[model samples]
Target chain A: MLNLLFSLLFLLSLFCAVLTGKETETGRALLDGAGAALRFCLDITGSLCLWSALSELLAQTGLSGRLSSALRPLLRRLFPRSAREDGICEALSENLSANLLGLGNAATPAGVRAAKGMAALGEGGREELALLVVLNTASLQILPGTIAAVRASAGAASPFDIMPAVWLSSAVSVGAGLTAAFLLKKLWRCYR
Target chain B: MALLSLTPLLLLGFSCLYALALGVDAYGALLTGAKKGLTLALELLPALVILFAAVWCLRASGLSELLCRLAEPLFRFFGVPEETGLLMLIRPLSGSGALAAAGELMETYGPDSLIGRTASVMIGSSETTFYVISVYYSAAGVRRTGWAIPAALCADLACFLSAAWISRLLWA
Candidate 1:
């Protein structure tokens, strides 16, 4: 799937550039993009390491265990059988807690850990994985500090004024995403 | 904003203190977790390079802009300003790219204006859809993503529409 999308984008870009005689610009962008991605990887590594280390500490100290157990009832509803697995539940709870706290990039390592844990459960975890991806993609952040900061720097009189709108929209999106995921899964099973 | 920036510091401090209280080997655990993080980073690098290249190619070739222009009417029908067309399209593809677009829109339209507010709300609400899907799926070794992409894109659409509508309801 990624291959197909990437190929389509690559071909479309090539065709568009050729048509507009901007092939040089496209080539430069490709190289620059790759270079930037390398730099981004290096940059993110430090944060990922820090967050993952914190996650380990949280888990080892039973802090995240407490957090996960607290979150278990809700996660159980969302994840069903997968919530029964202690490993997956802990990883997921950490991810959810990070996200709720608006930890931004810090949430990814825990999310990745959760994803890996879900994958370990084999095919039965498929629906749970999809739901997890949907929840992450919906991204219900409580503070949304980054955007507010952007607005402030841009000189908005009330940068956090849009908080209500952000919250509402995020809530709506999560609902929409989950509904779509479940409906699609049902449809998929029927088709099979 | 200060509190926002201080969150990670507080989290780190509190977690470490808690770990110590629990008699956990925080240092060794950090080392072990860092190793895992490094491995995850290495695993992610190839996909990141390829995805970035694809997105950059579309952006540099003006294909993304073209798509945005073509989709402008649809966005407008959903109450999104036509000026924010590129933002709606890019928000799900790349986080930094969307931030840059949002910043540009706010600067051009004035952050107090409807377009600026809508863009800000949209950015705050939406996630990098393709990025999240790819990273999570790849990390989990899922070759076939099934309906994850479509479902997540559905969420992004809801986010965009709701952002525009709610922004207008309160600010317009």
Candidate 2:
């Protein structure tokens, strides 16, 4: 059913493109965009593979375990269900570890893992996952090294120049997103 | 040469600290979680590919421009300029498209320029609308997204306004 909907939307978009009278240019742009997306996917997949390997190695070497243990207290507060403790800790640690290294690509898998873990424990699927998505999207970090790397790769003069703004904006976005999620959740619960 | 040589040593040190803090008991758990992570990566890849292709097709077809035209007045109500309406629409569809548009604005108008600053703030703060909405709604099996769009758009507006105001206060 969802697949059908997605296909219909895609066809509609294509129709709109043709109707816009730049079918040729739009087709070219679409090709370029697809190429870019493919590249992005490849890059992200590679990063995730590396992150997974490192995470496994860290586990073999006992680092991941330690990180999870250390993060337990915080995780407990965030997810008070004792049954969900291990999953929450593991997910949070994986996310924070990747995030700290400024690997947006790698962090996504960890975030998904966290969401799945949360879902497994029956912690409100979509609503809870939406909060996580928002949190990840509005992720607060001291270093936006990934963006800087992209800037440098693109031949920017000073990749670090955007750091201050990145910090400020990320902070506000994360705060706002968390607040909204919390308020919305509370409101939903009350209304129900 | 020296910095490159030091990188491994630093990584090793961090790894050592990590192992010590996390300990041996949690190793099994970590492995389990990592496997789950891999599965998720596999699952999301195809959908992302399809969505990217579709968005690209839309852009190439010039549907984005028409959509932008339709959305212009709506964006203006939130204090975003008419020129940037295309960006708000594109940003949700494609990160690169949004960034490219923002980069062009920055290059033409200067990084600290009002439009550039606004774009920068918008980039970091706003959600990738349709993607997020669809994912969340589907995950919850929601048939009616009655208030969701309006609520999210309102949030987007707040984000835009706050970003503009804050950037102006600090940079301008």
Candidate 3:
């Protein structure tokens, strides 16, 4: 899917540049494109390092276990079987909790660990994996600090003034996502 | 806004206090895990490059504008501005790209303008759906992504469609 998008973009850019007589501009854009991406990655490295370190501390201190127990009822419902597995449940709980706090950068490592743990369950777990992906991709973000900051920087008198709108739209998305995932999983099972 | 800026510090302090109370070698664990996390980011760098390059070219070459032109009527029905139509598509694919695009719109339309407000709200509401899928599934070494793409994209659409309405109801 990504392959298709990338190739199409490259081709379209070339065609557009030629049509508009802006061939030189396209070359500049290409280098600028890579440069922008590199800078973006580097910018994230600082937070990524901090969160990774924190996650490591989380495991070493067994806070993840405490966290799992704390959120046991909800985690169990989301991941019934895996919630019984201490190691996996720890990662899953951390991922979901971090995400809810709008700490997606912090959520990545734990999300990866949780995904890896679910994959270890072997066959017949594809549905669970799909559900996990959907939830992670569109999970409600209660804080959304980054967006608020952007709004503030852009000079909004009240950056978080849109929190109610964010909450409403996010809940609607998650609801739609969960329903689609459930229906898709059922249909997939019958087909298989 | 002040609280939002302090989140990272808050989380950091809480974790440190928690680690100290637990008598853990927090510093050692941090270095170990940070190194591992850096490596993961390094490995994913190529994918990020590909995604950003494509998005950049799409914007610079004006194809995004063309695509927006084609999709305008549909998005307009949802009350999104013509200039921000590209954001509805890009927001679900790349976070940084979406951020850059939103910044551009906010710059052009003023942050409090309808276009800027819609973009701002959209950022908080939607996720980088494809990016999340690729990262998680690849880390898990899962070959089959199943119905995740469709389901997540459905959520993205919901966010996009509601962004304009939500922004108006709140800010208008």
Candidate 4:
């Protein structure tokens, strides 16, 4: 998928360059793009490191665990079938807590653990597993750290000013995702 | 609104205090986490450079602008600006790609602009649907993904559309 996208963009640019007689500029654009990306990454370094360090500290201190455990009730409601499985409940909590903390690095391992355990239930676990994935995909983090970092680096006067908007959109998206999931499951069951 | 900016600082302070109270070598943990972050940055560099370059090339050739123009009406119907068409299109496929496009959009329109805020909100609210679906399903060995992709895409669309109006309502 990524390969196709890359090739499509480049191919069109090349074709446009040919028609516009700006081949030389097109070549420079690629170099400029690389340079910009390097600088952008550099700008992101501080916040990324800071957030990761903080999340790490939280994880080590068990604060993240507490957060995850706090999610237990909600997870129970969302993944009732899988929640009854051995160790799956704990994994789901950790996954969600890590995700909420914006700890993407930590979230993946725990999420995979939950997914593996859920998948072990065979055909009966499909709906619950799907729910888990949707929850992860549309999971709402308290802080929009990465996006704020990007905005700050881009010279925004107030990078976090979009918090309310982010919160609103995230809630709407999660709601939409959950609704679709439930509706689709029902439809599939009826058809089956 | 004003307090929202303090979230990161608060989280940091709380983490540090909690770690200290727990008798966990807070300094050592910070260093370890920083190392992890450094590693993450290193891993992110190549993808960032490649995606940024590709997006830049597309933008530079004016192809993106033309495409945005073509998609403008559809986007307008959804309350999003035409400039964000590329961002929305690439968002579900790749995080780094979306970041690159968001950076470009903010740079071109200024980060305080409605379009920029909308991009930021959209990026914050949504996830890489296709990537998440693939990773989670493949890891669990689930062959038939069923309705996951459609559901996630619906969420992405909701995020994008609401981001535009929400940004405008809140900031513009």
Candidate 5:
């Protein structure tokens, strides 16, 4: 998929360059892209490092486990077939907490762990997995750190002034995603 | 809103308190995780290089303008400005791709503009649907993600549409 996307975009760039008679600029843009990518990575690294480290520390302290237990009622509601003892709740809750912080780097490991747990015990079929996937994809955000960082770096007067709007849009999206997932489950049952 | 953005700092403080309470070498844990993060960031670099460059080329090649024109009517229907059409198209496929576009919008239109605010709010609200699907499904050994695509895409549409509407209502 990555290869296909890369090649397609490259070809599109070349074709457009030829059409516009701006062929020389395309090569220069590619080099500039490389530099921008590096700078972008470095800019994000500090936050990633801090958040992931704190995440690891939280996990190590067994606090995530406790938090997971605290979240049991909700997790069970989301993944109804899954049991608390199965450890799915723990990972899912941790992932949720990380996601709530807008810490995708921190969320990744927990999300991966949740996936592994679901694969092992969630023989409940596609519906269960769909719920998990929807939860992750449309997960709500409080900070929206990465986007705010971009706004800040771009010299926005107040990078986070977009937050209230972000919070509203994200809540709406997640609600929409869950509704779609529920609707799809019913449709799937009819087909089955 | 200011307090919301400070959640990360709050989490950091919580970790410090937890580490102190547990007596579990908090500094070591932090460093260990940072090392892991550094490695992960490095591994993600190649994809970034390709995506950023491709996105830049797409815009510089004037292809973005053409694509935007094609999607302009849809954006119009959603009440989003035509300038944001490229972002709406690329957002679901790639997070970095959308980020690059948003950065450009911020630079060109200024982050406080209707265009920039819409871009940021949309990017903030939606996930990279295809990317998340591939990663999470493969990791969980989920072979048949039945009905997930439409479900998630619904959410993406919600984000896209609402970002335009809400940004307009609140900012403009």
Candidate 6:
């Protein structure tokens, strides 16, 4: 019922916006927005395509496998259970690589794949998957390359200007999100 | 004329190099991903357009002015400028809008200027509230969003306070 109300309000606002302006003004704004959106879309698509291709090549060359092996120690610490499991380490490496490069579009699928690999070790249930979701959400981003790229494309004086703040905020947010997720999971378990 | 002539060549070279390095077969991957991106963009477009239009109309209709008047005292309590309240309201809906406003403030004042620093700090440190709410809650199938809204607003307030303090400490 509340969802219906929100949807109604949203639709009404959209309708009113469309009806408010003269045809010319509305057309112009739409065109401008479309152009900006297209540019943004293209940038992210290009990043994803390039990263996907690179990841494929890395897999074929066995470099990704080696990289996974190398990072296993650290990966074990991060995801203790999943580290010993097959394919988990490789997926984690791929996800981490994409994330570090700031290719979120590319990273998402790899993260999902990693989670699936992790979940194979556990029974299929909501309780088991909750931790996976939290970890994915808490995926540590050293740099928000996508947002930085967007800001650069938007003509910011210094694209790297937000780097410090991004690093700080992401660190805090990831820490807080993980802590909350853990506490909630524990509390839920206790009640159950 | 020279720069203009070189621009296309530079772009073409970059594209060719990128394609070669990535072993792009048909450019179809690019096209497919771009199509997805366009769809995502279009999905968000109506909401964004409606949001901006509503805000603009509200200001034109004097509702924002009245709200601004009402918010003056509250703004003072936070050591934020009266205009900052308008910005706070807008920031949740549109990141670009907030950034533009912040840019204007930075330019009018100096980059290291108090107001400029504050605005930049605010812009950098905060998330678009409505966007976060819509994405996270909708994905989780959360309908109430009552507690969520308050929690988010409280976080925003904390961010604002932290931003102010950090800006003063770092830049001032």
Of the candidates shown, which would achieve the greatest TM-score relative to the real structure? 4
Candidate 5 interface CA RMSD, Å: 3.4
TM-score rank order: 4, 5, 3, 1, 2, 6
Of 2 and 4, the candidate ranking higher by lDDT: 4
Across A65-134, the per-residue lDDT of candidate 3 in tens digits comes to 5654577588788777666778888888888777766656568898788888888887645567778889
Candidates' DockQ values? 0.45, 0.22, 0.48, 0.73, 0.58, 0.10
Clashing pairs in 4: none
Give the candidate number with the greatest lDDT: 4
Give the Cα error of residue A23 in candidate 2, in Å: 16
Off by over 4 Å in 6: A1-71, A123-128, B1-44, B65-172
Candidate 2 residue lDDT tens string, A46-139:
3344345444444456443455457666655655552255665577667655554444455666666666565555535445555655655554
How do these models rank on DockQ, best leading?
4, 5, 3, 1, 2, 6
**C-alpha positional error of residue B112 in candidate 1 after TM-score superposition, expressed in Å:** 1.9
lDDT of each: 0.78, 0.55, 0.74, 0.83, 0.78, 0.50
- Model 1, A80-185: lDDT tens digits are 7778888787788878876765565557898898898888888778778988999999988866765665666667777767777888999999999999998999
Which candidate leads in DockQ?
A: 4
Task: Estimate, for each residue in A1-192, the C-alpha lDDT of model 5 and write its tens digit.
Answer: 546767888999999999998888887898898788888777667655665676667667766556556766787778776545466667778777767766676677887887777677655734666777787788577767667766766666777788889889999999999999988888988998
Q: A52 in model 5: Cα distance from truth in Å?
A: 4.6
Judge the docking of candidate 6 as incorrect, acceptable, medium or high: incorrect
User: Mind listing the fnat for each candidate?
Assistant: 0.77, 0.24, 0.68, 0.80, 0.77, 0.02
How far residue B35's Cα lies from its native spot in candidate 5, in Å, is 4.0
lDDT of candidate 4 over B1-172, digit per residue (tens): 6677777787778877877777899999888888887787677788778877777777777787778888888878877888887788889988877877887778778889988998999899888878888899999998999888888888888888888988878777
Question: Given the true complex, what DockQ would model 4 score?
Answer: 0.73
Q: How good is the docking of model 6, as DockQ?
A: 0.10
Location of the lowest summed lDDT over 10 successive residues in candidate 5 chain A: A81-90
Docking class of 1: acceptable
**Interface RMSD, Å, model 6:** 9.1
- CA-only RMSD, every prediction: 6.9, 8.1, 5.3, 1.8, 3.5, 8.8
lDDT of 5 by residue, B36-85 (tens): 76785676577667766877788789987887889888768769888876
Writing each residue's lDDT as its tens digit, candidate 3 over B66-98 gives: 888898897677676677765665777767657
lDDT of 6 by residue, B28-89 (tens): 54455445544544554444444344344443334445656888797767666655554565
